[model samples]
Target: MNALLSKIFCAQRVLKNTPPQGEIPDDETLLRRTFRVAWPSTLESFLVALVGMVDTIMVSRLGAYAIAAVGLTTQPKFICLAVFMSLNIAVSALVARRKGEGDREGANRVLAQSMVLTVMFAIVITAIAILFAEPILRLTGSNAETHESAAAYFRIISAGMIFNVMSMVINAAQRGAGNTKIAMRTNLVSNGVNIVFNYLLIEGHFGFPRLGVAGAAVATVIGTMVALAMSVLSVAHPEGFLYLQFQKKRFRLERSTLATIANIGSSSLAEQLFLRFGFLTYAMIVARLGTTAFAAHQVGMNVITISFAFGDGLSVASVALVGQSLGEKRGDLARIYLSFCQRVGLFCSLTLAVVYSVVSRDVFRLFSSEEEILVYGEMIMRMVALIVIMQVAQVISSGCLRGAGDTKYVAIVSLVSVACIRPLAGYVFTYPLGMGLFGAWIGLVLDQFMRLILTSIRVRSGKWLNIRI
Candidate 1:
């Protein structure tokens, strides 16, 4: 196992070198650097996803109603987080560019400005989520029984949005400064804390009160607070790569910096909102298929999300490397990093696909005992295996584009492929044709293929090279 792992890590050493711009590293050196930034990020993402799986498994014991309720909240929660998450993309890109230019003060200023915006947005989202949680759940097609627990979970989690968004943006800024390990460590510790609290609170172990679904929300909020503290400390450390001395004087907004981040982030915000809207529509279609099918769909999605962690990890590396390379005015180097990231992402996806295909049944058995759910989930897992192959390419390529400040085109593609095509196809397949849950997945797979083709075209065209942050 160790030998196989070593070989995988060393695989990039063999890629033919791109023609050098002055002082560009050789292939081996560059690959090693990329690995250093990527592996920790990847492992961190995997661990976080794994914790989510554990959370689902723990809650599954409460009944399918609990699972479905939680599942229903996923897209709505993402919609709330979308704006801050989008801004993090801009924070990362600007930080990477400034770091590459060797302007430490500029990078620090960007981080400071982002922190200000992060707090403001989090407050607004928290208020809306708390005040309208029930309505929001109902809008997503949650039935009465599910709506009650979903509302509880949403309100508590929403109350902690400030901490969660702060932690996320700070970590993103760290990644932009080529310090992925700090973010990785912070996330790992936070997840560890979450799991422990989940065990105690959810089941009332160790004499803790059994708050059930609300317990999960409380645990998550506490975990996020811990992470936020860690993130702030990392950034405040004197020797840290992106240290900022937080002071009243430094907290004032600079209009130009705000404009720059907004310019880059607006498209990302639109993309996320559109994608979330499409997901809600897709979920509603599945929900209409009845509770059993929707529960199975949710279980299958939890399993599939693990594979996404692999692509997400590589995407993080792609964003950092491509942004820094562009900052250095080395478009050729950015291309090389993107190619390397895509290859690594492909390998990870294919390996995950094989594992998922072989163990589909056993995996579903962990989530539910119902024969119908297990059977439907197994079939969905097979589709997920195929989707991962195409999805990885699209994800990594989009990250590369974001790093280049070319978010508008990525947003347009998502609006067309995911927002328009996916749910529309899912509705047609699920109802008019009566294909059921399997039919819905087929629509999702088609969406991935469309995105893959479009993103691949954009990356190859080199139009992103002209984008200015």
Candidate 2:
């Protein structure tokens, strides 16, 4: 076992054009550096995903329509967040670079500008989402049974967008500055709040009104509000690496900073658009499979999301470590760190794959008791075990590229694989081949592998090291 694990984690052995074994940091040193940042972020994301799965379990008791209704709001919520998501990517990358360059004020400037943009965008998007909630849910393939509930959930969630986006931008900056523990703490508290409220309001426990689907949305919003407060406080300390200056002079945005944000964020926005479009279309295709199937699909997705949490946490570490290394003009170290990240990501993915395969049936049973839903969920989750291996690797690769300011390449990859190939393949398999939910998942699997292949090629070429922010 020790020998096998050694082979799995020997990063330099697998990477192309790597430095000599003695040139890079020893394995113990790399592991400590990586996990120092990774463990908190990993725990944060895992807890949040765990809470989300628990939230679904609670809602599942309300039946398949309820689960489907909640699921219907998923893509639209992310779509609403796309702008800030893109901006935050820029914030994290830029901040990490500035930190490595030892320009404290520049990092803070990036934070201020991103916060300003997040606020302006959030307000407009929130209003649009609220006004057009019905049409949007309908477009997501919401039927009469789930439409009204989904719309209510969507509207409530949309109204709270300001809090969520604000917290997100702040957390992004924190992560880039290598202050990952702050964001982790904030999210952990936030998820805790969400679960408590969900218990109180979901089924009317402790004299609370039973709000059902609407309650879940309310719980989520309330949690984000808490997170926003904690995030703001995190940077309020004067001695912190990232201090939030509220004064007029310090808070005003500069044209050069905005231009930099635009340079990186524009491509990131394109990537987000492609991802959302492809995911939305794929989801709509599956929704057409009827409520039970979609519910099972949602459950399967929730389980897969648990695996995604680990990948996302590691990806955050990669972005910060890679960006900082490049800023310090040590491209060799950047490559080394990236390779180590990939190795760690592989270990995590393989571990999750095994666990998912072993307990696929029991995991589905946690969400529902229906024989048909269980059967569908088990098959889809078995696929998830394979998909996660590819998904984690690609996600980390993309993060490494983005950290190097190679957003355009990642964006192009998303365009070709996510926007074009995924949905097209899904449609053919679902309708033409009559493969149903499982077919849609095959498209997802294909998408992950395509991304892994393309991004791996880009990483091997080593051109991203020369790209400048």
Candidate 3:
């Protein structure tokens, strides 16, 4: 059993810390506190993806064409999310710092500004997607048969961007406040509603006609609205640590605040853009290998996505913890927090890696009955698991750097690894050597390896310790 499990879940170790006299909490206390914040957010993220998985299951009944259509349409969804997540990156860091410094007013200002930007982006993105929906679908490599449904789905989902942005922005604030339960509770409510709506609308159940492609988009919209409502209510509740009150006079954007947010936000946005583009590039390559391979890739990638969602949660906690420690003028505390988070992430990622290498075939088989797809998917995913497990250090360390307001450098490093090196490696490996599918997957590993080195060096050098605001 041990050998069977070694393919994933290999990293295992407790977080360590040493409390100062009447100053820092003891190691056990610190770890527990961080875990309390991280666990729910992590679980929430995992569950968030589960809801999507369920949506996929429900939509699959429409047939394989529908499944493929949904899968293809989701690419643009990722791109849009990548764009908006940038602002959340800045919002989380800024709000965390403000809360740590006991500046609720400042945090509120940041939240308000984030909302404004999100609203503006929503208007622009939705208009663009709606006006040129067909072109966008074509750009994503969709065939004519799938184009109509994909375009329609994209159009409607674009309308929901406002609510999606609102929910994300609010959670960014709440997560940065070191209060994740609010976000988790809101997600639970929204996801529950989403499942019911998807079931009812997709199948035309309970007197509702089956809406097909449009139904999925409508379900997503309803979920976003519900999630937004929960977010607004949560923030408004007296006991909630984070809430937004419209400011009559605080509407103007401060240059310093804009500069900080833009600096961090743009950096984060750039990294995700590059990362997603890399994945999209790899997907294109896989698409050439055969439809079967591409479909298998899609199924296997979801597992990786599920795993990374937890990593995202852990990294977010690292940001909040490190930012708060810095706000308290405790650089040493921040460093300690950084180390502890790094250790925890490393352990969790490695553990999952072991699990994948061993039981990945069984896991992959759960999603597909076709032996060929399962076999290839198991092989490919095992490759991903190998790198992803050790790469948690890089993710958490990058989060630590961003938390300390070193966003620009982090962006630079990420661009080099993700943007330049990754695509270049993939191209060379694919075209010149004829390595094809395997080459593309291996290229991803190399990109992550380089990122691991860059992030580790940045964290160790302590230059991020000097950044303020």
Candidate 4:
């Protein structure tokens, strides 16, 4: 017992000293810098998630059909915008590296090329969505009663895809430049606008047209347009850190820049596609259980996504710090930043897990008064509490790898765990074992654990440090 205690003491000491190998800043300095970048992003993501929850709560009053209608759109909408979102990841990483290298022209050029790409992709995706919204809804397993509302919402939102994509890319560029406050403010304003309009339009509170589900779609579009305008103005401002030159020469598509961004972005795109496909399948499986189950699942998802916002906020910081560190040829600093982010993510997740576990019943009650929905939703939230810490760890690690231009590995791992394992496990648990919604959540927890293990392995291997954007 004495020898064991001595070994435990030695391990504790080693763990305490084990940051990445390099001269890191003092803990206070590191924490300050991390929060300087992280808080704005965290606030923005939390506000976004809050808006989603509000949307769910508001629509829940409309009935289960309304909830399922909106929920059905989530994965499909993500699939539609996957390309633009992935491209923005590349834009963020490239802009960060250029900024670190003090190459303002290079960074601006990346922005310009990214804008051009965004416009083209947005136009194409919008056209496809507008043309195929119904068919896509049907393919995603929307039932007869829900698909009509889903299609209407999908069409209107798809029409405004350009606004959303542009807003995202511009904000991503600003984040890469370490100007997170702009994005935060934009999202905050947008959320406020969305909530106000959702109230006015959904139920026709203020003599507005009672558009129902279409009202929610319209509100989102308008909010996105407002955000797009804010982002554009910020970048166009002369005193802005990443102000665009808008010269004809600057607007020209540089093949090398395009190729480089595409190289990094393709992996991100694949990862999103894999994840979305898995979600699509999972949704389909749940849809088979009927409307109440799916609605309960959506409510559970909205609440769980709240935890993701915190992790994602830390992820934004990781991307900025790690990308900048690598650009300065300081792999050690990159690793140190990643370590700090992981610690922050783990703590935040633990807090969220405990809170959700304790108050989950109350939280689910906020979204629905239906006893059945509330019961299942609470169960799902409890399952979420069990897995959120692992989920956040994986998300932050993926961000670190992304900043280091190691997206392909992340994509591959996601494909294996989320895309492949999750749906398969979900089906087995939900149908073969007859565990219902509980089984589906078990599959989700397994996927999170798998991702946590895989991403932790990749980050610890330190191979990402050598990857060059």
Candidate 5:
């Protein structure tokens, strides 16, 4: 038990307290302090990834074709999420700043506007995704057999965009205000619900009719709906940090607040779109490679996504802390927060990479048993582990940039890294050199290295603070 606890907290940041009234801690303290805040977040990511893995497994059983289909579908979903999720981060940054400066009303105003924006964008994105699901699936290199399966699955899951957006927005808001436990609990219960529903609905266990791929869709939707309810209850509860008593007057968003969100968040939305776009391209390339490679990439990607949750949670916390410090006009505090997060991220990526390297086969087995797909998944997983150090640097530095209202620069960097660098590298590696799946993995690894070096330099140079967003 003690060993497990140590593994969890090893080299993690400990920004569990509200930032001090006046002074930022010293560099040594910043370097050495256990990242306590990151611990819950890392565990929270584990639970979320577990659900994702289960979702992949439930779909994988139908066959690699289904796995490929869903995997292809998820590429766009990440971008879709990036769009709406940026607004959530915008809200979090704004609210954290206000809260840091001791202005509750300011924070509440940001939350109120965030809710309105989240719903409006959700409706717009959902319509486009649902209406164009078939074409998008076609573009993903599907045959007739795969397209029909993917379309049904995507359309069903896409139906719940509003719910997913709401949960994400509110959760970001809560986390920014230093209330992460609630979001953690919300995900835990929500993932459990998703797992149970997937088991019963997919296999037709206990009187449920077999729904196959569509059943996985249904389970995800139900999970989102339940999570949405919990988030609403949290917002309604007076004690919650982000609970908003939405007044008709407050609904008229002040231009200043609206501008703050848009100025920063537009970059985030764009960054997400491009990032996902690049991922979609990667998916397309994998599809072009062949169905087996595509399926392995899908399952392997899911496992990687689970590992990614750790970096993401830490990044989110970094954003809150860094943004709050900047809001308080304490650049020193921001620096401390940024440094601590980078160190913790490095530690996490290294540890998780080691684990991925050791238990990769078992991890791959959770998704598929087909010799071809399993081999592909294991190779990608190991490759990802090798690149873990670079991944850590990129995630932390990106988060630091985002927290400083430097969303535009971050967006630009993402485009260069994922869109230009990764896909281009993948093409070069695969087509010219004939590296295949290993080549694709190499592309990703190199892209990550470029981002880590560039973003770290950007953070250390302090140019991000000059951005007006």
Candidate 6:
């Protein structure tokens, strides 16, 4: 026990330690700067994640099939959004670098070029997703009873792809430019709209039609539309930091700009692909265990994702801070900021870990009262509580690397751990090992730790400091 406690303290010291090369801000200054950027992003992400959980809770009212049906569309939906998602990473990093360089025009150019590419890709992917929705869901382990409902949900979501991707790219640029509050405000209003509509549309309350599973999808799309409109208005003002020029000439894509975007986005795209592939495979493995298991898994996943939001929000701060510092030729400051971001993330993760563990069973009950589901979900939540610590650390680590244009390394890690390790491990544990859903979660735990170790090593090596965009 003494050895264990010592090791834990050692780890905490290492995470909190900052390099001496930079004139580090005092603790109060560091905390204020970190929270100034992080809180809005964190709140935005938490609200967005909360909306997903709320969606599950509302849909669960229609029965397990409805829950499973909605869950089935998740991976395929992310799969379709993969390209834009990767591009948005580049957008955020490049915009931050430009902001630090004091090249406002370059930042706006990055925003415009990203928007152009996103639209072109969104159209093609959206059409394909809608056309092949049924076959895709079936391939994802959807069955006779769930396939039709899942397909309908998938199609509605796909139909709104343009709006979602556009808003996402713009918001990414906003975050990179140190304008997190705009995105947070946008999501706050939009998610509020989503919840209100969910209440009215799901079971025909307040004279709204009963659309069932499709209603959830529709509510989500409506929220995205609102988000897109707000995102555009955000950049429409000519005086804003990331304004979008309406002139046709300003929209012209330059080769150098395109090359820069491709340089960062291509690798991040590979990472996104690997991430979605691994996650899709993992979700499919759990789905094969039947609706009750999948519903419980989905609920557990939704709950765990809330913890992820804290890390993700802090990661947004890390990316902007690291990229901007690097752009200003302050590698020491970059190092210091990332170290501070990781420490903040670690604190939040530990807090969430305790909360999830303490209320594990009660939390699952909010979604379902089935005895088997309650049993499976409780165990999963306990595992998730432990996973958040490593998961958040790795996520922030990856963000730091990506901001420094070390996306190739991050992508390689994703390919190895997420695409390769997770699915294989999950299958082996779930089948050969006979650990059931718990076994699959064991696979997830391994994946997060592997990522954390690799990313931590890279961050410590400090090689990412020299990478140029």
Evaluated with TM-score, which candidate comes out highest? 2
lDDT of 1 at 225: 94
Clashes of each: 0, 0, 14, 0, 7, 0
Report each candidate's C-alpha RMSD, comma-separated, in the order given.
Answer: 2.4, 1.8, 4.3, 3.9, 4.1, 3.6
After superposition, candidate 3 runs with Cα above 4 Å error = 1-22, 238-240
The lDDT per prediction is 0.87, 0.91, 0.76, 0.87, 0.78, 0.90
Residue pairs clashing in model 6 are none
The candidate maximizing lDDT is 2
Worst 10 residues of 1 by lDDT: 9-18
- The C-alpha stretches of model 1 lying farther than 4 A from their native spots are 1-19
Quote each prediction's TM-score.
0.96, 0.97, 0.90, 0.95, 0.91, 0.95
Candidate 2's residue-wise lDDT over 1-469, tens digit each? 7677566556566455555533566656776898898888888888889999999999988999999999999999999999999999999999999988999999999999899888889889999999999999999999999999999999999999999999999999999998899999999999999999999988999999999999999999999999999999999999998997798877677899999999999999999999999999989999999999999999988988899888888889999999998898878778878887888889899999999999988998998999999899779978999999998999899989988899999999999999988999988998899988888888998999999999999998989999888
**lDDT score of model 5?**
0.78
Query: What global local distance difference test value does model 1 have?
Result: 0.87
lDDT per residue (tens digit) for residues 294-367 in model 3: 55666666676677766777888888988988888877767767766666677788888888888877765655
Distance (Å) between predicted and true CA of 75, model 4?
A: 0.8
Taking the tens digit of each residue's C-alpha lDDT, what string does model 4 give over 1-469? 6565344323223235555554656555765787898899988998899999998888878899999999999999999988987898898898888877888878888899999889988898899999999989998878988999999999999999999999999899999888999999999998899999999999999699988999999999999999999988998887766988778888788899989998999999998899888888988888889999999999888877888898888888899988988888877667767777787787789999899889988988887788998889678888989888888898899888888888999899889998988899999999999999999988899899999899999988889989878
- Runs of candidate 4 with Cα error greater than 4 angstroms are 1-23
**TM-score-based ranking:** 2, 1, 6, 4, 5, 3
**How many Å off is the CA of 108 in candidate 4?**
0.9
CA lDDT of 180 in candidate 6?
A: 92
Q: lDDT by residue for model 6 over 6-125, one digit each (tens)? A: 443332354355545546565456557767888899889988999989989999999999999999999999999889989999999999999989999999999998888999999999
Lowest lDDT sum, 10 consecutive residues, model 5, at: 9-18
Q: List, residue by residue over 122-220, the lDDT tens digit for candidate 1.
A: 888899988999888888878966888889999999998898999999999999887999999999999888989988888899999998988998999
